[model samples]
Target chain A: MAAPPPAAAATTRTGALTVGLSPYTARTSAFRRAQICRHRLPTLRCRRAQPLTAAASSSPVFHGECFVVGENIDTDQIIPAEHLTLVPSKADEYRKLGSFAFSGLPSAAYPTPFVAPGEESSRYAVIVGGPNFGCGSSREHAPVALGAAGARAVVAESYARIFFRNSVATGEVYPLELAEAGAWKECKTGDIVTVDIGKAVMINHTSGKEYKLKPIGDAGPVVEAGGIFAYARKTGMIASKASA
Target chain B: MTMTEKILARASERASLEPGENVWVDVDVLMTHDVCGPGTIGIFKKEFGEDAKVWDREKVVIIPDHYIFTSDERANRNVDILRDFCMEQKIKYFYDIKDLSDFKANPDYKGVCHVALAQEGHCRPGEVLLGTDSHTCNAGAFGQFATGIGNTDAGFVLGTGKALLKVPPTIRFVLDGEMPPYLLAKDLILQIIGEISVSGATYKSMEFVGSTIESLNMEERMTLCNMVIEAGGKNGVVPADETTFKYLEGKTSVGYEPVYSDAQARFVSDYHFDVSKLEPVVAKPHSPDNRALARECKDVKIDRVYIGSCTGGKIEDFLAAAKVFFASGKKVKVPTFLVPATQKVWMDVYGLSVPEFGGKTCSQIFEEAGCDTPASPSCGACLGGPRDTYARMNEPMVCVSTTNRNFPGRMGHKEGQIYLASPYTAAASALTGYVTDPRDFLM
Candidate 1:
């Protein structure tokens, strides 16, 4: 049988579908294509993109770094069931998940069995992680919690595709390109790492080298609009102002 | 492509679903327990409010299993909110803790939806079901497709009665022989997960076939189906057969619509396991995927040994444990906890002392052997009740339980290790203070 032509591939990669004809396929028969297309890889980022706004600059850019030690850190570690009972709104949800680190909590007051605690790492803007970062169930809460905990970006050798997408989609948990995450494992938790997410650059203060990172796709819009809620609010404000 | 890929390929309404392809699926049923109900309904109310009446109320089931007895005001409020919500919506199956008495009055109640639905005839073979709780896949025993979803997804289903589902491909498990006398369905699943690793079945639908599933009673069948998620597969199933028909005969009473795989049906991947030669398997602490033989399990000192869940809290499960207790005529080395998955099982099938080996109801026998009262509000510790972790670390305790997913810090403590096993194996381990095969107690 002849190899079928490439299916439709969508343009702009906003969870859209686009199909392209392959060189070898027959002209008359149908390929029955799925329009849902993923982004070009290695450079694949989250689904939103916008520019850095003035308000973001005023924050002075929170910057610090730490390492997530293990692989397959699931959503439960970031948020426990006990905390869900307390809050009703989605805005407060991330706060609960971020506060309940399972082990190695940077603070003495918070001692949970699962999270690792050291050097207020959660307060850091950049998180240097090991292999298979965020490998487990697809709880968008993991990224939500990390972002609420003040993690501006996650720099790992590799990331679970779903977590990577969710982090970027939410305009937080930025995935950075760290070809060798192991090398940075030795970097202390409080080490500072300068991040220019737009430039996809990370300067490890201790190592004094600029490490390349993947820009969170599409998420630029949400980040520019100040997170998903902020983005929604801004859009609403624009729509209301325009209607008036 | 893997077995999972093939299964998904066959199931996809779309032609081909490459990796990372997101496609929507047509759903069959949506279910939730009271734990998720508060949040799920809250979201639904915020999103749709009174307009939530579009979805068929009969299709939704709200069970109050978690936090039924904590007497915590929050827990009470959660339960009350779901009760009122279900009433307002005219939801058909709103099972409360007190409903345990109704099921006890009628032994047909079985246990969690995994067992109860089979007895009630709600889950037919070859159908798909979606539930808010991860273990909801337990409905796969009767060969139905099932999985767990989040509160938001469930809320979506509750409001629109539809979801954006991507049909998961199928992985076929072929069981070849009759189960050894000591080994049962739980071992079969444990062995499968142990072989494939924790994430092996991730994003796949598991289909169990062969002689082993054929020989299993619906209860035993539910045990295997309930644990499919441990393999990373969201749903597990066995095609409906004579066993299924016989089991469902009077319970559901609906006109039978038998669904089956075609004789020429294809599977993405095929797995073969011999049940006859198998010994009991145990998953060591921190991960249900962690596996070892009953005898090979070192004397992991015990803090608690819980034997109940949709997986192991059936009548047969209770009977299996009782047999071991009778055979040993001794108290367990540590706290041997037994929370019958359903009140029906607890009141009628279990909770009695037989008088032979001290003749206690299985619950009483367990109590004598150091078990606690059935957790007040429902399947408590199994779903994160306060009992899972020891009060303090350095407590030096290992809990041999039948609950799914023994991941690290799962039982609320990193130090606590949970061993997953059949009820029989758990009882034997409890008696010996070390992992012991059920066959040893058979003599």
Candidate 2:
């Protein structure tokens, strides 16, 4: 929109290596150029053109705009079984994967899009939910879809046990449990929020409020390592324990 | 220690155990179906590398039950990915769709993964079974420490044949006194869930004790354990008895030593239930724990009736429904779909190969009663299958179903309502096109 950010255009021409765009630079750059050129009017151009990719961070601190949802948000509403496809394969085409996150949520009820059209999923990194988030189905795709959609963490009053375990085991997204008192009430959509896993607290930058969250406990190291395999490899358990 | 504790201790190779202690245990059987298999295979390949082989091929079972009959290319592709992985890995327990000729045709396929896991004897007593499906806890009926895991954890188990688990505290549910004639295991479980309030047993094991539990058949016990996840339980275990051994008689060749709780074993919480007073129950729309007596919700209208899934599609479940429908002398008022949980159940219901029913099966009885019987054994409309699935709702429909979960939009359209009930209640409700208690028809 703002003249296609000269640097992004230059980088697109050179096909320079970027953090998340490294794998699909050529294809993404072409798509970006087309999207930029197609929108002759500044208002019509995409706001955030950065490929919505998971940024590899060294620390457990995550900061982003919050997307708030209500209680008992089941897995089907997160990502319906119909949209679960092998197209663009999850390994190579993450943007495609992220596009369908929360596609199952009935659009007529919540006019606010979970991942708005033409907006980069990178705009949202935190999800705020009421009680019993991820309440139905053992589908790991629920968290995977959210993670792929650029959610770094989900803060809720409670989580279904299987969903909690799946989130921790895969390290796809951090599931932070908050107390029932004012967890969901204190946060609103698009509120700037920072979740500090090390401190076990979530701070709302918009409202200047702090909420206590449950500690990750035994699952902390695994999530910090970005998944069980990475944790096992780091702790040297993969060779001994996995082989046995 | 309780039976769950003892099983976990032995699996993790520990001399002792305690609640809330994290420990790694070896898995005996691991299963993944079409809906979750592709993601699991993708994760397994990405993490363990393409050349990485599963820990044990024979111990793993891959079944394509969901999204099988649909014409959607994507759903079919999901199965293709599983088939490719199975072929590449040379896995022996992979059950594939034999015929894709017609969408409505009865394809050659094994039943639902959870039912097949038990029927095929993969879920042995005193062992651990893990699957990518939440209903994998259904195997705990055999006195095993079984639980459902997501794809990533399942991938880890696929590559390593082990999972890290925190030993959950055991909650003893003593169902005392004799069960009433009309009360099935479904009624008892619904009553338990209503009391527990869904999140009551979060991260805990539920140990079923007392005479009422012991009196239930293996299918009934499996049904009880299958829905423990509905109440946020880690697993539901029934101590192995002669009934368990008789059920497992030639199904499993693997030697197993039954595990039981010590007489003085401490439980985190103990509760007692009088099964004799239990009545037919239904979980209202939007929540499995929002339970009410079936009679209380009898005035609610319905558009369809679904009787299937690992929780309610067994042979005994079918027989129960047939008993009610055969005696009613009426065709189903609304569309009624009958799906058997497994191939054996299907055969038994149809009196095809099983002579135990004197060649007159539940399928014949239901067919005579004007119920649509799909030949394949699958989890249709249970977890809400594809658009063309036999029982899926197209609009805002209210259905009385026998599946475990009653989450909103679970069976089909987001506006659709589902009421969870037993097969008997479901059949009765289907006949009247409304929520009617099974007793009313029986009387």
Give the top-scoring candidate (TM-score). 2
TM-score of each: 0.74, 0.88
TM-scores for chain A over all candidates? 0.55, 0.71
Which digits, one per residue and each the tens of the lDDT, describe model 2 over residues A46-96? 112344335422235565567888877888788766555543225434455
Candidate 1 residue spans exceeding 4 A from truth: A1-64, A87-94, A103-121, A126-144, A151-188, A191-244, B1-21, B49-51, B97-119, B253-268, B351-377, B386-396
Q: Count the backbone clashes (under 3 Å) in each candidate.
A: 48, 0
Give lDDT: candidate 1, residue A155: 73
Expressed as tens digits, the lDDT of each residue in A103-128 for candidate 1 is 42222322322223432124444566
Docking class of 1: incorrect
Query: Where is the poorest 10-residue window by lDDT in model 2 chain B?
Result: B351-360
Task: Give fnat of each prediction, in order.
Answer: 0.05, 0.50
lDDT of 2 by residue, B270-355 (tens): 98998877888999987888999999997898988989999999988888888788778788999898888777788778764324
